[model samples]
Target: MTRARALDLARILFVLLTLGCAWLGFRGRGDEIADALADTSALGLAAALLVTLLGLALTAILWRRILARLGSPVPERAASAIFFVGQLGKYVPGSVWSFAAQAQLGRRHDVPARRSVTASGLFLLVHTATGAVVGTAAVVTGVLDAGGPRWLWALGLVAGAVVLALPVVRRDVGPAMVLMAGVWLAYGVGVLALLGPARAGLDDLPAIIAAFALSHVAGVLLVIAPAGLGAREGVLIALLEPVVGLDAAIATALLARVVHAAADFAIAGLAALRARRTGVRPSPGLRPADRRTDL
Candidate 1:
């Protein structure tokens, strides 16, 4: 079989495996999620989704900055559509899918494949590094204090990626890491907001944030799980249960997965519409080729 076909098969099998694991886990303890949902606060969920959206928007801005730095900048609308729509690929198995999608989508907006791919690579690198650093700090402060040394390997990986991509994104390292930290912070806040600060308590905030960041890194590094589906939830629950108890931890994990997925599609949908209806208008001196820019 061709490499493409093999990859497709692997994705399908891994997806099935993830689904099977989820089904079994939920089957035994489905009542926890249901009970949690019964007690769930609408205001909290709404607040969570709002913060999650804000984080996602920040991510798009980061991508746009990366693109511009690479000399293949698209308009804001074009950037949104390209970035969000490309992000849909993360739902598929494989960490590289989103990057590949971004690179392809960019070509429609006069962004060359090479620059777009490079920018996406750098974006992931910067994002991973920030998540690692933040996660490590959080862990040191409260969560898994003993495991902090082992987790330094994650920091090492980040350092290696930054070294490799530094030449291209040297100017963006500081800002990109800061922006990525903001994204994680927003998501951490969203998780707390969803669970209700009363449940997690202000004292638990740092641990919650640490759990959020580390669980995400675990999910991404696993790679076999689509969008970190089963892996993220498992790691999240594991990290949170100690602080929040089993029921609240499970609820937070499940709700976060659903809310974050909804947020992703929402951003993708709106950006797709915006790009389709109103991207950058062509100027009078434009060539016919430039006028044909597809959303």
Candidate 2:
């Protein structure tokens, strides 16, 4: 079979797996999930969705900055569509899917394949570094205190600082960091909005934010898990347990997963619509002609 056909099959299987996971996640807590849905305020859901969109917009801006720095700048609209739509590939069982998607989508807008790949790589690096820094600080500052060896957290902080310094050393600083900060902050806000529907208190806001950062970082690093399926929720619940108790933490993680998945699909759908309207055809896989630009 051709690579395109294989990719199509893989995508179908990934979708099935994602749905299966979601179904199992909600199965044991059917009544609780239903109650939460019934009690959810329309306004709260809208607010969460809006915050999610804002976070994605910030992420798009960050990607644009990265591409421009790599000397393969595309228009903002193209960048937004490429980033958001490409994000859908994260649901697949490989970390490289999103990068591959972005590189192919970028080529439609005249970006060289190597530069596109570099931009995606750099974005992930910066994003992961920032999450590490924030997560470590939160833990060290007594926010989520997971009670591991203090030296390990300290080492993580040092490593994060070094990773973060690479971009600054390369003179690709300032706006990228600011935009990434906004992206994470918006994510924190969206999580808080999820908590609102559950009537969870915001007294431990600092811990919650730290948990968000740490769980996300953990998820990203665990590339074997599709979209960090079980890993993210496990880490999130573990971090939140001290502050919210086991049951509430579990509920929060489950609900947050559903909300986050909805947000991702919503943005991806919008981006797909935009790409279609602009007459841009998404490449299913790399062709011989497309592989000329080496990474």
Candidate 3:
């Protein structure tokens, strides 16, 4: 098989692995899911979905800010759609479909494939780092009780930073870092607000950060899981149970997945409709001349 084919296979395996993990997580634990679902009120689920959508929108804004700093700015509508649409590509395995779609759209905007990939990578690294910092803070200050296994936060940050600082990433690292810091500050405030009465005292900050970090991390890893079915719940049970209790955390993760999938469907559906109306042929990758065209 070719290099691309090998990479694709790996992603498929990741999806399978995620499914296996999720199965193991819930195996013989039917009562756990039953209890979690029973406690999950419709209002609570709705609220969780709203929060997830809002968080993703904020992420889109962050992406726009980074792209502006990169000199290949894409409008918010296009960027947001691209972000949502990209979510569907995880079904292709190896996550290549996401990159492939990005490259295709970027090319339309006249962006080089390398630059497009770098841009996407930078956004991910920054987002992950920001979440890690916040999650670690939550754990540290007693806002969350998972402080014992807090090494994961530090390790994730270091690994993210290393990838971001690599030579290829370095070309855009300067601007990306600056934008990321600003965004991180905003994100910190937002989550603190979410924690509301739960966030008090500086000691609680690290643990709060850790919770947010773990939540985001869990969401991301869901891409490799089958339709994100059990992966989110598993992560909540593993990392968030100590902080928020298994039932609440599991509900939160499941609700988040529902919202994410809804957004993806909404965005992709609109894109498809628009394409059909406009009679524009859809290319498989990013073209260089599409930067100014509206999606």
**Pairing residues by index, what is the TM-score of model 3?**
0.60
Kindly report which residue stretches of model 2 are placed more than 4 angstroms away from their true locations once superposed.
1-32, 167-170, 197-203, 278-295
Instruction: Please write out the lDDT profile of model 1 over residues 77-195, one tens digit for every residue.
Output: 88998888777777766677777777767766677777777778767766665676677666655554325365575565466455535556565566777777789989988888877
Angstrom error at residue 41, model 3: 2.7
lDDT measured at residue 95 in model 1 versus the true structure, 0 to 100: 74
Cα lDDT tens digits for candidate 3, 1-295: 9975775575455445544543453467566545544655555445444554555556666665555455567555555555555545654435466666666555544556766666676677666655655555555444666545656655765666676666645665566555555544443333333333332334444443455566666656666654434554465446655645554555545444444555545555565455436544323333455332210
On TM-score, the leading prediction is 2
lDDT of 2 by residue, 190-223 (tens): 6667667354566666677778888888989999
* Global lDDT of each candidate: 0.73, 0.73, 0.53
TM-score of each: 0.79, 0.82, 0.60
Q: Name the TM-score of candidate 1.
A: 0.79
Poorest stretch of ten by lDDT in candidate 1: 286-295
State the displacement of the C-alpha of residue 204, model 2, in Å, after optimal TM-score superposition: 2.3
Model 1, residue 49: what's the lDDT? Answer: 94
lDDT, model 1: 0.73
Q: Give candidate 3's total backbone clashes.
A: 36
